[model samples]
Target: MANLDLTLKDMMAVDGAVGAAVVDYDSGMALGHLGGSKALDLQVAAAGNTEVVRAKIRTMEQLRIKEDIEDILISLSTQYHVIRPVSGRKGKGLFLYLALDRGRANLALARHRLRDIEENIEV
Candidate 1:
């Protein structure tokens, strides 16, 4: 596992990857970001998405699901937003957010790739 710079490059290599960011949910700050478009700001997306993760976690707590979130996928006509919260004590309150071109990506493979990235990524 390397650092943010190396991992971000790996993420961008995923098929159809548009952008990727390592974000700290607790602070709404991006540890690093790459490939964001003018129409899609990774920093803004990271901050706003932290709330989405928080709310989901809160809801799960209230519901007593006792399960962890592996990843979240939000799809639109032209794009996909994937939010993956980092697990383990070392990864708590941090996440990787990725954007993809809807027509170009395979969701299942992308999810698997993201998992691999998460597992090997270094802070």
Candidate 2:
């Protein structure tokens, strides 16, 4: 299984990846991050997205939807943000976040790869 550093490296290899991070949604803090520029701060993104994840889960609970979230996608004019909560036993409360350049990314493939990475990661 890949460690945190390897997981982040694999994420950056995606065609249009501009930034990636492993975050703890419970605490709104990043465990590790890679590839963000001044325009995109990984730490801030991690904290903001924690709220997104929490809100979605909370809403799901209130609606009585028992299924777990597979992933959350945020599409912007220039970028695509993918938030995937890790499903492994060791990864509870953690998530992988990836930002991609819209013009260069293949969203479907990126999602598929992210899923693979998530499954194999060892936290």
On lDDT, the candidate that comes out on top is 2
Per-candidate local distance difference test: 0.91, 0.97
**Collision count of model 1:** 0
TM-score of each: 0.96, 0.98
Q: Tell how far residue 62 is off in model 1, in angstroms.
A: 0.4
Q: Following a full C-alpha superposition, what root-mean-square deviation does model 1 have from the true structure?
A: 0.8
Off by over 4 Å in 1: none
98, model 1: CA deviation in Å?
A: 0.6
Off by over 4 Å in 2: none
